[model samples]
Target: MQQAPTVLHVGWMSRAVDALVRSGAEVTCAVKPADAPAARTVCARTIVVPDPTRSTDVLAGLARAGLAADAFDAVCSGLEFCLLDAAAIAGDQAGVSRALAMRDKFVQKRGVRDAGVRTADCAVLDETGAAATALPSFPQVLKPLDGGGARNTFLVADERELTAALGQPEFTAGGGPWLLEEYIPGVEFQVDGFVEGGELRLMSISRYVQNLIEVHSGGLVAHIVLPPRTHPELYAKVRALAETAFKALGHHDGVFHLEVFQHAEDGEIVFGECGARVGGGRTDEVVERAFGVRLHDVWARLATGRPSGVTSSPGHADDKVFGGMNLSARPGPVRAVPSAGEVLDRPGVVYAEVSAGPGTVLPDTTEATNLRAGLAVVSGADEREVEDRMRRLADWFAAQVAQETSDTAG
Candidate 1:
């Protein structure tokens, strides 16, 4: 009997692993040794990663314990994790030599731009002082060159903010480095898709609406609402440009996530950044809802050499409306908490997950939108229905927490 095609996923559990499993592949997970339990729960095999937490041993250990060349058919990463890109290529050296370029902001843009693709002006700022020298544009974006999940990203409206942001301990290099670029003002959208044998297969398009601009304008904490109601032409532009970016990255197979800015007035689409894996935080879930296409399933099958039997794009007219929204209660010392059952029962709340427990000290609201005490994923027949459900769910959640606190007081 033929061996079950083996697939390897890297670093942390995500919706992508579930997608891959449903596609009929034996999955292995690669994670930091300490996180083995979580990784094993998600896959049959687990490979411990190089502990890069310390300054002295960061990249050196990774170089020492890299994967063998003949390990797995395909290797994948999630949540802006770049090590998977390195490991996948390490597993299949010749087939994936150019893979790591996708994770480095400067290299990725330079390569894409050299290939004649349209991209925002960007440069890697190795030193904080160099930021002012490398690109003098105010209202710039500062980010870790190899980071993921919208963390440590900042929008500097002026030189002072840029200076202050650069001064933050988080903004400084942590073994790796950061990037600064001209702030591309426009509506943001993400392209989630995959490449098979050099062919680009489009999956889904998501529009992002950020509630507040803090250090990271990229919704450090924000909501992803699918089936953007207002931008049809802009969506088309993003799709086309996304295809161009895929080719420019020299990526021949696997999932790709590209974030872009479409200037509402000029219709120009600027590439902000990209990753060489599936998007994180239930992105595929929302895509599956709005388009009736499962990106996770396709990604999984490809890892195991199973053909993605997907034949067409989600029919544009599907009547079922889907929306995924995430929000957190106002930040402070959480004086009270609600039971998960109660949050789930609120009208219009299809699914809800709270990350904080009572007495959890919620972080300060640097970004008005992503100060998430928790998140709720809801769907409906239309946007209004989703919004209404979200509002009711929010109200219900607030009331429940209040009651919990009141009861405790009594």
Candidate 2:
């Protein structure tokens, strides 16, 4: 334990490398050959595998990188799609089975239900059913059994809609297995939680202003913590639900992100899905800004078998955030761009980044990939300040697009 623990991180390069390195871990990444350059810039060493999604292939490549059966102290994957592979490999390193349970949606969900955690009723659908009698009810959700975010995730109202959804490019491209579930109608919330030494601690919960579907469909992305006045009760509910999921999945170590819903009709809380990794989006950023402890640090320590390095912070931003928002330019010409310099000048603005320049072409707001034009990670004196700043920044972005488009038309 005196030496820096070597961590073999599987999947795409991400902020995790920096966090683990800062924690004194020697980081080596096993990534797709195409991602080797980016991974090398961040990771201490890189091992390029032909296809990172295939666990067996990655293990073969890791062997080529001189990775032995006991080569590393810990193993993990950053990308959701690669978690399954990360887990399979982690089993060789950690000699544990936490990886498989959390890798497949079908397996993960069934485990939860068997353990008595409430989840959306679901069925595995590997092939399309008769269009006339496909669903037992309307408003069913169809998604890949192992995909993340809202990729090919569709809410269908009836049989005709089911056929239409099945035909969409996203669904068809998901390839192979699928899951159809009763659409849970409720207030959606994403929870970032940690489980260490068999104990589950809810770290951050951000309520989404737009359901993931809307956010992924291309538009604005926003998530804010609840005011402390209502946080205690809400936090308790989310924590209870998360703990149940952690135990059900045998998640004894590391961090997890849980997707949950508060049923709008029955006022009951239920699970949507959960990840054995940090939830995507600026979640890690929001959690760090609000809490002051970097999530990456915690994850690295956990994966490397080191004690946690985080000092817990207030559930809600003690004095900082109303929430965080990512502003996206609509699909079109980026004739003009907003100045991050001006945004920094605004009071209560904690962080901001504008990713486009004049003549930068923007794709139509249709997915998370296109939401990167303008991004703001905010923390203010209070909720009102955060809200007002977000609105103002959003307006400036819209105005920039409008004026640019008008000039072009003229």
Candidate 3:
């Protein structure tokens, strides 16, 4: 009998752990103390650490747990913040460099651009609040060097807006070394897939309903998966760009979530950024439903150095379109909201998770797209139908929700 591979998974991803267990791997999870309870449920062992994204903390926790570095066949993380730590603990030098490049937007863009890929002109703003190089054009984007979920990201139209935005605490208090890039005017899209041995294994593309930065100003954060059969030319162009960017960034193996832009006028593809993990916001569910690929399971297999066992099924290449949305609400004291069961009962709604209910104080939506009132996945016969369903769902949910007014606030 063969022994199952042992995996050291960092962070607390319930789905990743479950997939690893289902793959017959002996999984041990390292997570923050607060997540230990949930980690304990799916993993054979759980090492509670103060911070799972810190390699030192994770290594020390593993030592305290009596688990040697060599005991595991792989070290992996599904969280963007923990990717570098996982790679470092795994002792994979190449993987560490790849993680670093992916985590730091400045490094990533420099490398990709040097490799002859078209990317936004960018400069690094160091601790002194000064750009390493001259600033880009008037319309520029400012974001954390290692940020995700579009948090602390800003689009400034001019010097006034830039100055005002920079005054925010996130830029002033120890948040040095930000990335300022020329704003690319185009329709944004995301490509999700797995790569192995420096080769593109599988890929899927989805067009965003609105640019993520717009989410800070009350725009909907939603997207519909584009079927390969329907958008062959688009898939080809995006795949070409993604393959080039992935190779340039040295992302040899792992699941990747890449964002790119299609030039609004010239239709040229421009690389935005990439992550060494699955895309967030119901991406895994939408991809599986549209392409018949379970990304979590694929991640597990790739992390364990096993074949991905993922193959595009021609049968799934029908006209059926799938989409996902991060339900949003205005900042206020929530009065009433629908339950997950109620949302699931709606036609065309395949998956629903209602995170906010009555009494939940919804914070300002400017923080991140992940800070949602709820999330839902819908399916339709085509893109138009899926989009309509998404709008209807959003409107219906908003109408059902009531926020407490000043007079009602006791």
Superposed by TM-score, candidate 3 places the C-alpha of residue 190 at a distance from the truth, in angstroms, of 1.1
The all-Cα superposition gives candidate 1 an RMSD in Å to the true structure of 4.5
TM-score quality measure for candidate 2: 0.88
TM-score per candidate: 0.79, 0.88, 0.94
Q: Would you list the rank order by TM-score, best first?
A: 3, 2, 1
Q: How close is candidate 3 to the true structure, as a TM-score?
A: 0.94
Better of 1 and 3 by TM-score: 3
> Number of the top candidate by lDDT?
3
Predicted model with the maximum TM-score: 3
**65-176 per-residue lDDT for model 3 (tens digits):** 8888767888898888998889899888988898888878988999889988899998877753464234846788888877777898888888778888888888777766
lDDT for each residue of candidate 1 in 309-343, tens digit (9 for 90 to 100) = 67764443356455455545545667666766667
2 versus 3: better TM-score goes to: 3
Candidate 2 lDDT: 0.72
In candidate 1, position 177 carries an lDDT of: 60
* Candidate achieving higher lDDT, 1 or 2: 2
Whole-model lDDT per candidate: 0.62, 0.72, 0.85
In terms of lDDT, which candidate is stronger, 2 or 3? Answer: 3
**Candidate 2 regions with alpha-carbon error over 4 angstroms:** 91-97, 130-135, 171-174, 216-219, 227-229, 311-316, 333-335, 369-371, 380-385, 401-408
